[model samples]
Target: MVNKILCATRNGIGGEIVQVQANFVRALPAFVITGLANSSIQESKQRIQSALHHIGFHFPALKIAINLAPADLAKSGSHFDLPIALLIALHKKGIDTQEWFAFGELALDGTLTYNDNIYPLLLEIALRHQNAKVILPTSGQELFCHLPHLQIYYASSLQEALQILESPESTPAKTQTTLNFDTIHIGDTDYYYEREFPLDFIEVKGQEIAKRAALIAASGFHNILYEGSPGCGKSMIAKRLRYILPPMSLEEMIESVKLQALSAQKPSYTPLRPFRSPHQSASKSSILGSATQNEAKPGEIALAHQGILFFDELPHFGKEVLESLREPLENNELVVSRVHSKISYPTAFLFVGAQNPCPCGNLLSPSKECRCTPKDISSYKSRLSEPFLDRIDLFVQMQENEQDPKPSLDSATMQQMVFHAFSAQKQRGQSRLNGKLSEREVEEICILDDATQRILLQARERFNLSHRAIQKLKKLSRTIADLDNAKDIAKSHFLEALSYRYIS
Candidate 1:
């Protein structure tokens, strides 16, 4: 009988199950793996060869052929080693690996292990093939403990695996992951921070208006831009915004985990929202993803889904890269079209950008003299086109020593306002945050009185705001009203929303 066992391979955001088919023929002894396996998978031959031998498996001279089925798609990862080894060693034992899938990397000595990189692919299996039985490394059993329906068996070594496969009916299922949406926190409670924010709003020394703008941005999930001289607390405020933003749902936590797992960085699986601050030097391909004929890779924007993407020294970035932010900023999702396939990735994130008013970093400083010429400042400002600037929901101009001697707002305090606003929106049955309201939803939630509507029209004409600008303004007003616990968008809220629209 032909021995068959299934394993996983990443296919875009999802995965594919590859069947390891082993055929032992009576011929000259040789081991071969076919079907476009990568060098890592190819290198697994010696490891698996030694492992089966070390586990006391020695056979008469025969040709051992292993082919990863569905040969059209290329496969990688050493996790393929275990299933292939199992198929080769257990064909005579008549063990039915067809009942479940297996995944793990093998050492020459027969130990089994995997990494967080496999977590997402494993999750894809859980999502697509619900109630599927899977045998994964015991090392990551905790990763799946909370997931129900799917049964898992953890094996740490080749010997341990043999014992389990020998008595399949008696082996118990392993622990799975359980996602808790209710264990949410604003800053320091139930959730975890990858690193403690060393600076607080209380330590910022000044710029209370900028802090208020930050609070509104956090409460509404609004895109914000900051123009100030260097060291003007712009970066400091952006850093603290994630912790103070609305609490995440269980779905968001899982999405965050998947995004990080797909990237080069390791997944933290924390409830804390992501805060991705890519430097100005990052490439367009790095900010937006890149795709080949067979694969698509996520960029900084996709990686920042359900969280924050901060650009410091925004003007210094490439014009193409800066303009590329338009798609995600406008539609909240990116549609990447290539020759063979079109793929979509979530780009829902709060885009926070900070730049000096001028290249010399002193144009807006009251204490320091302006060294940049008018033309120089104009060119520097031109880096951010009008279209791009119009997309920003909140724009704050920070002045030197507009700074207070002491800080007043803290993250906990801001989080309280954000949480209150969040509760207000939810109480009103709003499905999305204020910043993400659709045009129809904006009309539904943003209730402006006659006077407030007149002021909005007047401000729209005065500022020459586009329809999108008006919609964003309404959302901002709605957010301000929510923070104030007011039902209607008051005149003060409308004017306050308009005040932050201009760079001045």
Candidate 2:
């Protein structure tokens, strides 16, 4: 008799279902597994046999052949152990297997174990197969607690799992609580907005212009650059921008959690967007992604999807790493290619770069005298090319110090403005923020007044702006208009957008 069970395996940040088919025939006592499995999967037989032995069940004398279906696809992970063991044990008893999905690693002493990586696979199963049931380890149930309308059966050991399957009707499956998206709080608590952030905007003693630019950048998801002397709060402004940005939608939250779980970290269900700040010494492969012997993994860019990628000390990063971001910044995704494979990952992040004006950090400071030579300054600035600079939406020069240090903004006040701009984008049916809008979408949504159009034309001609730069200006203008709660782009908004263009 042939017994079959459903299983799943990870593929990047997603999951693919596998059919575990077991056949028993009269022959010499032996067992084998086939179908493009990796070393970890091939080693499952030993684990399964040990677990079965501990459960008081000996392997049958007949030859057994287990095959994972879809022979062309690569399958890895120890989660296949449970399904394979279940199929073989039930085949020996002449018990037919149903369509329930099973995933867990079997211990030598018969205990089933799982980790946070199971959450991505679980999410994949829940989304693709709505009516499917699951048999998972009991310890890792928290990952699926918020998922609704799914029937999950939790088992602690191989013996307990078999007993539950034998008398399936007696063991009721655990049901997920219904998540009301419309009514559910986005953050963990109602006081989330009022709580003090670790790096609040109020902490910055001066640089009101920089804070206003930060607010605009957060409101529209714009890529911004801050050039100033040391201790000018450049990094401080970039670090706190993520908190003021709008909350994520339910679907976006699920995607973010799934991506995080791929790294084997316990995923949390919070609407706050991710804020990734990789060290300046990170390698190109670490930021863009690379293929291992068996699988390709997402890099820092993918991890920062739909979030913030703050590059402090921009010139300190490798030239290759800094330039590689150009494609993802334009396309909202990245494709990493290796010798035999290519993997694509979403990288829709708000790019915030902060850097010193020169190596001595006093080229632009009025109070500090620059001791570096002209060639030295040129070399330091040459690390960032003009093409890369053109991608930045806002370029703000922070003040050396506050002549009048009265803070004009705080996190709470700026977040309210961000919410208004976010609502405007949603009202216009835009999935992305204003700064990431396509050229065609900008033309469609940002209706410019005659005076505003005339000013833009003059600026494009006078500045020798590239076609891309013109499009970016229009997007910036649209964001400025959104912040002002205006339906159309006005002359003042166009002027504010033009003032941010990079001069060098």
Off by over 4 Å in 1: 147-149, 170-197, 337-342, 405-407, 427-431
**What tens digits encode model 2's per-residue C-alpha lDDT throughout 1-504?**
678888877665577888899998899999988999989899998999999888788777889999998887789998898999998778657666657788899999989998665777888888888867778898776666655455788889888778767884845466544333223242332112223466788887778778888888887888999998998888888888877887666567778888887755568776678888999999998888776545767788998998899889999999999899999998898988777666789888999999998999988888789989999999999999898998999999887876455646788788888877877787787877888888888889877888888887888788889888888888888888889999888888889988888877
Per-prediction tally of clashes:
10, 0
Each candidate's root-mean-square deviation in Å? 3.1, 3.1
Model-by-model lDDT, in order? 0.81, 0.81
Give the per-residue lDDT digits (tens) of candidate 1, residues 406-474. Answer: 548777677778888987887777767899888899898898999999998888787788899999999
Which clashing pairs does model 1 show?
Answer: 144-176, 144-177, 145-176, 145-177, 146-176, 146-177, 146-178, 147-177, 206-403, 206-404
Candidate 1 matches the true fold with a TM-score of: 0.91
Query: 344, model 1: CA deviation in Å?
Result: 2.8
